[model samples]
Target: MHDATEATTTPKSDDELKELVSLARLVAYARENARDLNAEFSAYCLDLAFGALIQDLDRSGVSLSHESGQDSSLFGTRH
Candidate 1:
């Protein structure tokens, strides 16, 4: 379970790097306005963020649900 060469591997891809940067920014933003983020506002933000993420996944050809599952109507149509 130890490989020295593996530790020296190349950096992450552009997409991965961008995702990290985005997460860092989001964290920093939340920290900057700690008190302003109340429970209701946080819940709204989470819903919007997750909805956008699901939409992006659909656009990228990723399906979140199957045709014969109980959670089929949870996400609605791909579009």
Candidate 2:
């Protein structure tokens, strides 16, 4: 049986809230696009990996503020 004496709480931080929203969106996208579980899982995993990397950079004082100013192409210049 489940415990009735415990109380539940919602996500308190922006990161936590974003994670929940990302999960919901991922599942919804998978269902709507008929994507395979493997593909969806891979995408979610990659997203988490990149997000953590960026967070770590920020914590280490390596700002990604210039990210938007950099070239978005495959290389320094567009093809």
CA RMSD of all predictions? 13.4, 12.6
lDDT per residue (tens digit) for residues 18-45 in model 1: 5644543354344334435565666556
Best by lDDT: 1
Q: Model 1: which ten-residue window has the lowest total lDDT?
A: 70-79
Model 2 spans with C-alpha error above 4 angstroms: 1-38, 65-79
Residue-by-residue lDDT tens digits, candidate 2, 1-79: 5243321222135675455445434433443343344567666665565455444435444444325642122112211
lDDT of each: 0.45, 0.42
Scored against the true structure, residue 3 in model 2 reaches a CA lDDT of 42
What shift in Å separates residue 66 of candidate 1 from its native position after superposition? 12
- TM-scores of the models, in the given order? 0.36, 0.35
Residue 77's C-alpha lDDT in candidate 1? 22
Clashing pairs in 2: none
